[model samples]
Target: MHKFGVWAPKAQKMSLCWREQVLAMNGPNHRGWWTLEVQEATCGDRYAFLLDDDSTPYPDPRSLRQPEGVHGLSEIYSHGGFEWHDQLWRGSPKTGAIIYELHIGTFSTEGTFDGAIPHLKYLADLGITHVEVMPVAAWAGKQGWGYDSVSLFATHEHYGGPDGFKRFVDACHATGLSVILDVVYNHFGPVGNYTGKFGPYLNENRKTPWGDAVNLDQEGSDEVRRFFVDNAIMWLKDYHCDGLRFDAVHAFLDLSAVHFMEQLSTEVERLGATVGKEFYLIAESDLNDPRVVRPREANGYGMDAQWSDDFHHALIAVLYSPKEGESGYYSDFGTIADLHKSLKHAYVYDGQYSGHRKRRHGRPTDGLSAHHFIHFDQNHDQVGNRGWGERFEHLVGTDAAKLSIGIVLLAPYTPMLFMGEEWASSTPFLYFADHEDEEMRRLVAEGRKNEFAAFGFGGDVPNPEHEKTFLDSKLKWDEQEEGNHGDFLAWTKALIKLRRSHVCFNDGDTHHLHVFSDERARTLVMEREEARVVVNFGDQPFAFALLEGEQLELASRAEVSVREGYLDVPPMTLAVLLSTSEQFENRQVEARARA
Candidate 1:
């Protein structure tokens, strides 16, 4: 026997379009729910819902499998059938964990879940503790960044569907790495969204840059909120994902006593306890609100961490100033002082006026652990949103890129690397999608051009509709073994190794960390327990005074040197030095005694 159900409050009548037979569903009861059981229903049965004499069928809002795409019929797939071997997998510790973010489509040539399995060991060898996969929810396209997902529960069919994703997660756990899935709950895609026909799934009165805002505080929002909360639980409990990175939390507008984020956080914590595993929730917010990562008991949103764009802006602006007209947010950066503040405070605009925003922004993040901020020089947005979608290494030479990576990896904040960033992949991760509608495709291409024009980038924006755009974004895995790419890969490995091995690098205490910088000299120094990071961003080499018994642990470039009680940091280079004060004192005594 198979049981089928749906929440259609407005439906006077409902019918299930199962393969060939149309079965009448029960009712729109008090809570706007309908249920029915078909003894003949079995696994792999394709079905959809017809409401109120509307012959057109709509995919399930909580579909577990959309084999024919978002607009197609949902298939019956049992999650319990997959044999998982991760019961023994106690997740990796959060402290000092390195996250590697990748789009499954572009990460491998085949662009499927099974195709990515071979690379698990490679990332583990590179010292990455967590593998963050981009959104996999079914969207209205052949290929996309997966941000405009329509079915929040169904895995994209092109990426090997639900069972495929389960296998990927299972492989990740077995490989000694954790999986963090990116989820979008702020808004649904512009096409193939039929939730509104069933209930108030969106707040049309309010708007977001993407489209209508999700219904969080409006009428009939209780079920909407529960819908999202249940989705989070499904990923954690059913799919076995270790964590979730909520995209654009700042866009979620809710005025309830307990914000949507707070409620979600509370439920996730409860679910984690019940599942017998620790789960993490990371938010991507432009608000720079400390309340997002603050504890729930303290009346905050209670996210475990948030992406820190301040660090990326500061590092990029200081190292290789953004191109003219391309300085949208980077206009607020471009100073060594900004970089210093990012290192010490994790937010450069904390309670300060932002010229870019034309107002004061971002409250201070005092008393928060450094790990609460995830820092990176490049990410999907930073790279894919550009005019030509140039990677950091492409804009700046090898030296500056290496120095920036060195700083991010060694900083107290948790570090994340975009796919192919470690090896300096030459491919550009341009925005690309395969929307079937001709008008939608045209609008996307036009929108991209307008965005670049606003940024003062003068050039034809790459057409996101073209298959070449998507193909070019795929990583050239073979190039990683070539000359400069090979060297950069080795450098990245060493930095990660040092980070994992050193207590100072892993410590999340921001109070214990100290930063010093010279705006004129274009230099910065970060001092931690028993270690110091010296960086020179100027056109000329910088000489910094060395402490007694200080020795170089690692250097981003070969030009870094220590001699005559001074550490020579060449332009666009960073060096980590260990302090052996005890050894220095003993050597001083021996020299004095011999004298």
Candidate 2:
């Protein structure tokens, strides 16, 4: 026996379409919910809902499994079907974690959950504590970034559905990797979005970049808010995910007293307590507001952390200058000073005038832990949104890319790496989507070209509608062991190994963090206790003064050499130096005891 329920307040008559039968449902019963039961219905049974004498059926607004497609019937799914092998997995905390973000559709050649499972051990071996999977929610079409999702409750069928997703998560846990799923609660896809036909899920008065904003605080929006909140819980609970990374949270315009984020966070905490597992909520925000990660008791959103774009922007701008009139948000960050500020303070625009937005932006993160900021040199947005979808190494040389990465990994914050970034894969992560609508495809391709042209990016923009675009974005796993790619991979592994083995690299004490930069020489030095990172961004070699007993731990390039009182760093190189004093070693023991 199975019970079916849906929130369709305006329906004059609601009916359940289970298998070949059409059965009338119960009433809207006060809270706009209609319920029905079928004794013969069981797991795997396909179902849809009918409203007001219409013969046409619509997929469940909270569909768990869209086996056929987003436009097809919903299938009943039970979470107990899959056997999980993570009973002993206590889950790793996001603090001091090395997160690896990958799009499931592009991370593997098969583009499915099962296909991605094979690489979990590789990531775990690479010292990744969390595997941040890009959106896997059911979206329209087979190939997409999963941002334009049509069904929030269902896993993408192309990625092997809900069962496949569970297996992947279980495999990740078995391989000692926690999973962080990227979820989009800001907007729905432009196509195959039927939530409006059932209830007020979107605010018509407000508009976002995609379409109408989600009805977070409008009339008849309590249930709408519950819908998204429940969706988040479903992922953490039934899917057994360790964390969720909210996508484009800055676009969510909620004016409620207890903001949607607060409500969601509060409920998630309760759920975590009930499940007896720690679950983190990460937000991808461009606002640079520290309140996003502050505690709820402090009148904040209570998010675990947020993506700090200023760090990436400052580092990238200093390493490789963008074309004139093409800076966008990078306009305010093209100097060693900006990088220096980012190292000391997480945000360069913390309550400062910005030439990018032409206004003062960002509040200071004065009393916050640096772990609340997740820094990354490249991500899906930074790479895929490019005119040609060039990776960081493609824009700059390998040495410069390595230099930027060394700073990010050694910074006093949680660091994330985009898929294939460890090996510096040559494949481009293009912005590709497959829309069934021909006109929508054409418009997407055209809009992509115009968006880049406006940013002063020249050359041909890849047609996002082309199948080749999606295929080209898939990571070539074979290249990981080829030529310089193999060397870079080894270098990255050594960096992460050094990060884990050293006590200073794991500390998030930004107050004690000291950074010095010379704009004329294009050199920077970051000192975290006994560890020092020396970077040379200039075309010419730079000599950096070293402390007594400071030994060279690692170098991005092979041209690093030690003099009597200084270390020589070749252009576009970064070198790590460690002071192996007895006092620092004693502190390491104390730190471990406190932990």
Candidate 3:
């Protein structure tokens, strides 16, 4: 016998469309749950929910399988079928994790989960402890950015189904790498979205640029809230994912006592404790709200970490050499002081500013750990949102790439790397979508241009539906062995190694972190414990007085030197200063022994 269930509170009558036979589902069950058991219905059967005797069936909101397109029938999938591996995998700790974010579609030549398997060991060996993947939830189209995913419960059919995802996770755990899946719960994609027909899934009152805000706090929201919360848990427990990257928590319009994010975080944490594994939830919130990552005991929405966009903007405002109109947000960050404040505190705009939105933005993150902030130089959104979709390596030279990498990795906050960012791949990660709907595709293409026009971003915005747009974003792995890429790769490796070896660099302590900046000279120094990271952004060489017996641990380039209480820093370089203490020598010996 097969058990089937769905949430359709508004439906007076519901039927299961399975294998040319329709079976009626038992009514609302006092909690809006429709369930029925059938002896004939079995796993692998293509089924959907027929509401109010309508001939058209909508895909289940909690479907695990959508083998046919999102608009087609959902298939009954059986989990726990894949051969087990990584039985010893207990998950790596959250603090001091080096995360690498990559899109499965663009990361490999095959553009599938299995296609990404071979690269896991490469990242593991590269000192990456965590791999945060872009959304793989089932969405309409052969290719997409995955933010527009509608079927939150189902894995993207094009990029390997549930079984393939299992293999990928198993492979990652076996390779000593933890996997974090990025999930979008704020809004569903425009195309093939039929959730509204079944019930109140989209809210008309709450507005966003993407679409209607998910009816998280509206009436009859319990089921909608459960849908998303369950989706996150499913990824962690069912798929063996280590953590979840919540995409845009600020977009979730929830006024409930326990917000959707709060509830989700609580459940995930409970599961982690129950399973005796470390599960984390990182949010991509632009609100700069410290409450997102604050402890729940302090009456805050508990999350493990949040992406520090302020750090990216501060770095890009100066080093992003191709200073075009794409500097819409960078307008708020243009001084050495901004970079210093961003590193010292969590957000640059901590409840200050009026230029961007003509209003004060962001709260101060005073008590959060450095691990609560994830810093990065390049990411999927930052790169792909541009008209040309150029990376930091393309904007600034490779030398600047090394400098930026050092700044991000050495900072007290957790560091994340974008795919191919280590070796400076030549491919551009352009914004691309493959919606078959002509009108929807045209609107997206036109809307993208209009969105950037306000920011003065110029150039021909490529048609998102075009196959070339997606094809062009594919990483050229062969380029790693090429000219400048190889040198940059080695530089990245050395920096990561040093970060792993040094306790001060990798520690999660944020209270002791301090920063000093020279606005005129365009140099910044971040001192943590016994070590300091000094960066030079000036055209002319900049130097600072170092402590006696201070040794150079790492430098982005060879031009940086430490001599006689003077640290000579060259243009566009980074220097890590560490005193040659007995403790330092012992740690270095241990690091070399491990290496």
**Clash number by candidate, in order:** 0, 0, 0
Question: Which runs in model 2 stand beyond 4 Å of their true positions?
Answer: 583-595
Better of 2 and 3 by lDDT: 2
| lDDT, model 1 | 0.91
Model 2 weakest lDDT span, ten residues long: 580-589
lDDT (Cα, tens digit) per residue for candidate 1, span 1-595: 6789889887899999886888899987788999999988888999999998788988888889999999999988888899999988868888878999999999999999999999999999999999999999999988899999999989999999988999999999999999999999999998888899899999988899899999999888999999999999999888999999999998898999889999999999998888788888899999988999999887688999999999999999987766678789889998899889999999999888999999999999978999899999999999999888999999998999999999999999999999999999999999999999999999999998999888877879789999999999999999998999999999999999989988889999878788999998888899886778899888899999987778899998897887899988888899999866576467558869999
- State each model's C-alpha RMSD to the native: 2.9, 3.1, 4.1
Indicate whether candidate 2 or candidate 3 has the larger TM-score: 2
User: How far does residue 320 in candidate 1 sit from its true spot (Å)?
Assistant: 2.1
| Comparing 1 and 3 on lDDT, the stronger one | 1
User: Candidate 3: worst 10 consecutive residues by lDDT?
Assistant: 320-329
Give the TM-scores of the predictions, in the order they appear: 0.97, 0.97, 0.96
Clashing pairs in 2: none
Q: After best superposition, candidate 1 residue 250: deviation in angstroms?
A: 0.5
The digit string of per-residue lDDT tens for model 2 on 1-595 reads 9999999888899999987989999998998999998888999999999988778899998999999999999999888888888888878976669999999999999999999988989999999999899999999999999999989999999999999999999999999899999999999999888998889999999998899999998887999999999999999999999999999899889998998888989999999899898898999999988888899999899999999999999998887778876888888888889989888888999998998899999998988888888999999999998998999999998998888788878988889999999999999999999998899999998999988987788778899999999999999999899998999999899989998988677778898888989999988888888888888889999888776667898999888999889899899999999886675677667889999
lDDT of 3: 0.87
